[model samples]
Target: MRMPAAKKVKSLPPADVEAIFARFHEIEPEPKGELDYVNAFTLLVAVVLSAQATDAGVNKATKRLFQLAPSPAAMAALGVEGIEAEIKTIGLFRNKAKNVFALSQQLLERHGGEVPADRGSLEALPGVGRKTANVVLNIWFKQPTIAVDTHLFRVGNRTGLAVADNPLAVEQILLKVVPERFMLHAHHWLILHGRYICKARRPECWRCPIREWCRYEPKTPAPNGA
Candidate 1:
């Protein structure tokens, strides 16, 4: 297989960009994040723990964890040690536990145990960053913000949707190009597509719904041409 192109096309044409998302919407009309959360506060914590971890992994760890402490007050009661014990199965659980505990305290002390809708407020919480805040805002608050993770970064470049050197640049280009109607679920669509189809190694380009508009070169052939 050929190596991924070192250079990236700036972006697809507006029509192609529109069609790409249209295809995504058609394939999965109601795309959703894989993480399980009962409410905005739980969703916020789940996104924070998802750093460098798979959604499935985070979900598994958070299931009982959330059931035990579903709110900020309940989470704060867990303390760092208790939180760590529950999520130890995940990577960097100690640090994640500390962050969760601290953020839970902050939520209680600052926001009265409610998750904030504003980006700055959300990012101010412990363990929360731009990407995490964006995810929370997009998913829980119904904002049109795009959170650029590794998958989105790769897909944006490989598909010529919004190639850039870093996630922030890709996010900016996507914000400007992705249709307003699609912006709400754009990140989820791209993420699921990258995770299941346009993977980093051995992308399933043969069955990609948007292969016609995708600029990824040397598309992977189907097994024995099917």
Candidate 2:
């Protein structure tokens, strides 16, 4: 796809971007992370289930799973078959069930059934990737880590905030550009913005707050044909 021209406007300097984030904080000061979970263990399970699935879908599945098996020991004992039965509605339920069981086993053997705060340890678990590790680290441990999912990557590139090919590169650029004060909440702000407003196929730019800062061209809706 041809890259759209970013609308020409006064560039947002680092300080201006920081101010935007501050305003974001004021607007949604305690913007909670989307994925639902009760604790670290449950959080890990929820994130694993979230892959290739919507947060609403994952939450629907986990709402029952957590009630029955909230802890690693409880989950491990529940076994893959039992977990699969509960999460069958979610996408890739079988594979996710296997990974969740394996992750619980690793937690028991290595970290005494507690989710490790370290990125390396978290990623070492079955089905846990860099994005998952970043989410766990940032949300559970309060570390400043950005998990660049599709929404984030698109927003970063579309807004000319941090363009890159892959999530890792986008994440690195975001770390470098976003102010430290905004680092923790930046991921949520961007993700929420992209999901609700700056959608993939047809962005709802009319109600977008940062429309002026966007770099994308053809801002107005195009004719259905041609």
Error of 2 at 187 (Å): 0.3
Q: Please, what are the lDDT tens digits per residue for candidate 1 over residues 1-226?
A: 1124435665789999999999999888899999999999999999989988999999999999999999999999989999999999999999999999999999999999899999999989888999999999999899999998888888999999988887788899999999999999999999989899988888899899999999988899998847
Off by over 4 Å in 1: 1-6
Candidate lDDT values, in order: 0.91, 0.85
What's the lDDT of the predicted structure labeled candidate 1? 0.91
The prediction achieving the highest TM-score against the true structure is 1
RMSD of 2: 4.1
Worst 10 residues of 2 by lDDT: 1-10
